[model samples]
Every structure is written in structure tokens, then in C-alpha cells.
Target: MTTGRAAQARRAADALRQRIVAGEFANGRLPDEQALGRSLDTSRNVVREALNLLRDENLVTRRRGIGTLVTAHTYRHGLDRLAGLAEELTPYGTVSNEVREARVVPHAPPAITRRLDIPERSEAVYIERLRWLDGGPLSLDSTWLAPDIGHPLLHRDLAGRDLFALIEEVTGAALGSAEVTVHAVTAEPDTARVLDVAYGAALFAIDRLTRLPDGRPVDVESLRVRADRFALRAVLPRS
Candidate 1:
């Protein structure tokens, strides 16, 4: 496809993806390509390409005469706002955590140290968890927290609470802000086994640095989220 047509297809796919997430498609079926093309003000070929894109993402399936079928996941996590996994997924279903590892590390790696803005030799608390939504694994999170804020969590219920809430409760300070960077990464062998996806499957990798209201960095987290089970959303303003 030409660059212009490719762009149009992407735009069309994005629109349809949002509609699918919003439950706009009745009975999980989309309108015919010609009808979609008319509604989206694009060509039938463009709509076909758009549907193909969604199919590649495993969000839809095209049948010979039955039309397009929506199989997209129901949860849309907002990228514009900072919230815990449990908090964001609350509207959909119960979010639970299986704490894999939680302990105080005497020395964190250089990369983690830099993200938390701590000395290379500084002690940090490390917590690894597999987050589940309604009994299915959704994300695998590896978090490193500055000693001060994370020490109290050593004995707390890590599996039953949101990490952000735990941090605030432990420190008695509200979380101020967070810097998040999200990108796609292929699942490695260990990660794939943990999340139950095929090796080399695409996954969403989010690296976040969260801070206290006073600007002191407290937490740095790396999360691998299942692409097939979640969608990222954001509203941008043109100013």
C-alpha cells in the first residue's frame, strides 16, 4: 500500500478499535466493509486493510459471509492518568496479585538505581508480582522502591493491595506524579512462560518512575503487560 493509503488504513483501524472497546458493535459483529467505508469516509479497500490490521492484532476475525467479529479485550488502561493496576481495572472485575518475590536488596542494579535517583550502592526493596484480572494473568511487574518507603511493606499484604496505595499508606504522603514510558517488546522465554503467551509474542512494556509530593522519587517499576488482554487509552488536547 502507498504511504497515504497506509495512513488512512491506520486511522480507520484506530477508530474501529476504539468503537470496539466501547462496546459499540452489537453482538460482537461489525458492519460490512462497504458500510464501514462509507461511515469512515474511506474506500472499501482501506476498510479492508483496516480490518486486516485488527485481525493481525487478534482483535477481530473476518468470516466469508458473517462479516467482521470483534474479539478485543474489555479493559482499557488510561495512559493519561497515573493509577494502580487494580484501581484502573476495578470497573471491569476483581484484580488480584500473586507476589512472586518481595525482599530488600542490598544493592540494586545501576539502571534501577538511576531511575530511582539513588546511589549505586544504596539498598532498595525489590518486589515482583504477577497481576491477575478476573482469574487471568494480565501483567508481570518488577518494582524497585527506595528503602525508606518500601521497608514497611516487607510485612504487609502485598498480594491483596495496590502498590501505590501501600506506598502512600506507609509514607503518609500522597503520590505526586509519575513519568511513564510505554513501548512494545517481544516476550522472552521466562516472561512468556509466566504470562502464558507464546515466545516472541508482542507485549507492552511500561517503565515508570513514581515520586512523592515533595519530588523525591520512591518507586521505579518495569511492567510487561499482555497485549491480547489490555488496551492503552489516552485523550490528547490540541492546544
Candidate 2:
């Protein structure tokens, strides 16, 4: 069935994305199409589709002579600077992601509207994902932004893609500053399952409302990170 084949292609893409995020291809190139097909348990046609999706998202690029080359999509985390969740973990190890949700919201919620400063009736794009480092669960992020910014994002494969960069690129509204809040919380059932941790486990929650340089709100993000899996450090110099 056509639907079945579509599902297979999506699965293939997800698996490949996970591997890419996991740093399995440290040489920075994917296996040949046939080899990928065999390893991913899909046909060459399916493998081609998966690769195409990754290319569309700018995760990898094809060359005339060489195979797909992984793009430079990483940023370093700074203690005294503002950055995205992915950037915050660069000092740790290799980072990857699993996208759980990506779609459009017809009616933006009040809390979302308040943060992004969009109209109540306007739609938005919602992206929920779980990030990984060296094959272990790391953090879960739920992000929402204006529809104009989210529309183009709805089509691409997101695994292994940097959410912060994609948001700024499509929206043309880079994050100049953010209102951040930190909290200690216990994991809920859904959160536990996604992060592969026990329910009621202690976690660190980072909430941020980001704004563009011109004072326009860009996005609101909630990141629930596993306590033992990540560390946050900073330095201070007295005047």
C-alpha cells in the first residue's frame, strides 16, 4: 500500500537521523545508498527518500563526486552568553535528537500567544523533541513559534538538525535576548518515557521567552533536562 511505503520511508529517515545524531558516522559521510538500505532494513528507493529528507533539512549535502557530507551544524555553549539548549551541551559530548512532534497549531494557546506576542487567532508551529548524548537520553524540549516561522519547518526532517538555528533562519528574527527561568521539578509520566527515566525523577527545567533585536518576541521554550546527564557551569570575576 502507498501508506505502508510512506511509513517505511519515514521510519528509515528517523533511524538514520538517530544514528547521525549519535555520531555513528564520525567520518562525516553516510554509507552508500545500497549499504544504507541494507543496514536500515529498507529498499534503495526508501533510502533515497530518507537521504533526500536529510538534505532538505540541511543536515547533509550531496556532492558530484563524493557521497553525502554532513553539514557544520554545531555551536559552542557559553556560560556568560545566550544560546539554545543544544549549544548548552557542546562541552559534554556528541549530541543527537529524536523528534516527537512537529505540526501546526490552528488556534494558539493564551500562554503561547503571551510569550511570542502573536495574535490569539493566529496559528503557530509546535516542535517537541528529546535530545541525546552518546546514546543516552539528555533532555526534552517543547517549543512554539509564530506560524509564518513554523510553516516551512513543518516539511523538513528535524532529527540531528539544530532547532535554534532553524528558527532564526526561517523567521529572520534571531534571538537577541531571552528572559530565562530555572526550576527544579519531578518528571511526569510522558516526560519520563521520552527521556527513559523513572517517573518522579528529579530534573532541571529551563524556561525561556526569547525576543529579536528589534524587541519582537520570537519563541518560547521549555526544556526539561535529566539531572545526572547534564551539567551547567559558570565563572565570575570580581571587579
Candidate 3:
């Protein structure tokens, strides 16, 4: 059941959310409800409802006489480069990993094995980690590595290090490139629980396969990212 007011509020909230994330409000404060309503071509009640929605998302705060305030910080992830999460995010805030699962499996799933170019029933190393930015959960990464490259990482420190850097160290070869795909998905029960999001909350899934300079596949990873905490950016020139 959807009402006109609710729909309008959501629309208003989306617009404001983008502006806040873009740093349009340089002072981190928003105009009064009436002014915002006029700019957004809506009524004061609708604008108030929109601001409340932002408040629920922890993106804004409202006070009696102070009006609405933007309070969320979104990290920009450039899609044009091949870099690790920590490597890209450290400039903004501290990044850490919680290794939830790290073990050598007798055989990985068929699809993963195919992507890694291993035999159908070949063994592989599996790593599942929860990535934290500052003090909050940012993403959940599940990576499957070919044995030759992964065995060396079993004893290495995975908590405070980036897998990309470690992989280069173990192989003595720099990573050449990656095949990456990004898409939106709803959080499943397990993912929602791990990321502390409500069931069916919107999330960004990044699937990537990394190759060495010689073009041999070494890693296949899928990262489930918190949509509100991250944004993907890239510069594309028309050909």
C-alpha cells in the first residue's frame, strides 16, 4: 500500500541524499523545511517526512530551531583502477578485516573452480572476511584463491593486510588487471546478519577476478558492500 505522501517523501529524500553525499551542503547543514520544500517543489509536511527518512538512515539530524543537518560520510571507490579496499580507503579512515573463515577446502564450487581455471574437483583456499571502516562494517568479502598462490597466505596476517598486496608478495609478480562487475542486489538473510542490515536491504555486489602479469588467474572474489557507506566513481570518455 503506497500513499502519495509517502512516495513524495521518498523522492525528496533520494534527492537530498545525493546532494548531501556530493558535499553540496558545505557546512553540513540543510535549509529550513519550508525553504527545502520550496526548492524541492513540495509542501513543508512532505519535506519534514523526507528529512525524517534521512534521519532513520543516519544521514541527517534535525533539531527544534537548527533545522536538518547532514551527518553521513560516504567513501568514494574509483572503478578505473585496480586496487584493494584498504589501499583505496585508508586515506579517508582506518580499514580493518575480521577473518571469519580461512581454510583449505578439498574442492571449491564448480563455478569458482571454473573461474580460477582449476580442475573441476581441485582443491582451493577459501577466505571469508568482514571488512570494517573506522568502527563500522563496510563490506563482506568471500575470496577463493588458487592453491599455488593461497597456501602461502594461510599463516600470514590477514587481519590488518590487504589481500592484493599479499598476493603480489607471494607470487613475486605484480597484479596486471582485473575483470570486475558491479550490480545491485538485495541482502540475503546471512549477508544481512553479517553486515548488520535489515533483510532485503539494498546492497552493492562487486565480483572480480584477478590475473597476474602473465595473464594467469589467481583470485576470484565477490564483495558485498554496504550501499550507504560507499559510492563507485569513474571517468569514461566517449569514443
Candidate 4:
């Protein structure tokens, strides 16, 4: 059970969290505790409690002389939520895409054959793209889709476009939950060349296979993101 003071602190924290997410505060700086307490109709101690919670969440920093400052540097991806990459990243900064490889091929890689339920040497669309945030490389996404499923995308302009949105709009399929697996791997020669990282630099490999509402499999995505540029956060309740 939460005490009244704790509950009040949570409410204050929730309000500030929304404003920070909306980019209302300039340079991620929150006002002084006294000002925040007055605005929220709470006491200074309550405001401090709220700021402490946000600090624990990695959303702000509170120093004695410096007051409170927001320190949200990397994108915070919620593990319990499902959203398009654009929606996930747009809040941080401008997003752009560079389509590296977009074409229908006659062969499906052996690894994805079992996942896509296609035989070896089956037709598939292979798309390799680099995602940029504020003109800097952020992630490298390699996607393989069933040929008939993804060939239609070739006609559309893919540069600077959202992959999940394009697929949903074209296929009219309600994308369901994604089965994601995360791994920490060192960049290979090819990955290093594309991501502009050292040959053996650290990277995070995120593999996702999405399904439709009706249980139909779609594309398989292998995303290699700079480890320092991204993070995953989850809120777990006591069982």
C-alpha cells in the first residue's frame, strides 16, 4: 500500500514526466523545487520526492547547487509496449532512412527459411537500411520478407520512410505483437563498414519477427544498433 505522501509524490512525478516527454522544458531543465511545488499545489519535499523518482528512471538529474537537470540521452524503448520505429524514435530527434538494399531476390537465407515458412531458394524481398537520427548513423536494419508479401514495396519510395507503417498500409494487415530477442555482439567486418564502427566494436543485435492479428507471419528483422545509443527499459510489477 502506498502512503498519502508517496501517492502525492507519484502524482507530481507523473505530471512532470508528461511535460518532459512533450519537450516542454528547454534543454531538459526542470524548474526549481519551490516553483514546481507551487505549480503542483504540493510542498517542496513532495516535489523533491517526485524528482528523485524521475532521477531513478534516468530522466533527470538533481544536484544541490545545480538544481534539477534532465539527462535523458539515449532513446528509452519500453519492453512492454509495441510501436513503430518512427514513433519510438521521433520524440528524441529527426529521423531519416537510407535504403541500402531493396529488391526481390530468388533465394531465402537458410536461417530465415524456417521462420518465414518458406523452402530453401524461395523468393523473398531483402531490404537493408541504415537509420539516421540528426544525420548520424543510429541503427542498421536487415529485413527479409516473403517475395509476394514484400515485392509491392519496391514501387513505393522507401527513402526516409517508416518500414512498419509502409508494410501495414500496403498489406492492410493488423500487426500483432512482436517476438523480440536481444543479444550483445561485436561488429563484424560487414556490420562495421555499414555502421561506421570499429571492426570489433560493441553492438546490440535485436531480432524481431512480427505476426498479424490472424497469426500470419510477416517479415523477419535483424537490427544492429549502437549499444551506447539505445537502451531498453521495463516496469515490472510484483507477482
Query: What would the per-residue lDDT of candidate 3 be over residues 1-239, giving only the tens digit for each residue?
Result: 65699999999999988888776897878998888999999999999999999888767888887878776577888988999988999998889999999999997899989999999989999999999998999999999999999999998999989999999999987899999999999899999999988888778999999999888999999999988778888888899
Task: Enumerate clash totals for all models, in the order shown.
Answer: 0, 0, 0, 0
Q: Which whole-number lDDT from 0 to 100 does residue 236 have in model 2?
A: 73
lDDT of 4 at 167: 80
Model 2 scores worst on lDDT over the 10 consecutive residues at 71-80
Please write out the lDDT profile of model 1 over residues 1-239, one tens digit for every residue.
Answer: 45798999999999998888877885889999999999999999999999999988778999997889886456888988789878999888888999999999998889888888889888999999999988888899999999888899988999999999999899887899999999999999999999988899889999999989888899999999988778788998989
| Model 2: per-residue Cα lDDT over 1-239, one tens digit each | 35676678888888887676656787888889999998987799988888887776556788977988776332223456777766767666777888888988899898898778888767888999888877778789998977777788777657876777887777676668888888899889989888887788778798888777887777788989876444455567888
Candidate 4 yields a Cα-based lDDT of 0.81
> lDDT (CA) for every model shown?
0.90, 0.77, 0.91, 0.81
> lDDT, candidate 4, residue 75?
64
* Pairs that collide, model 2: none
Native-referenced Cα lDDT, model 2: 0.77
What ranking emerges by TM-score with the best candidate at the front? Answer: 3, 1, 4, 2
Writing each residue's lDDT as its tens digit, candidate 4 over 112-155 gives 87788778878889999898887778789999887767988887
**Model 2 clash number:** 0
Using TM-score as the measure, which candidate wins?
Answer: 3
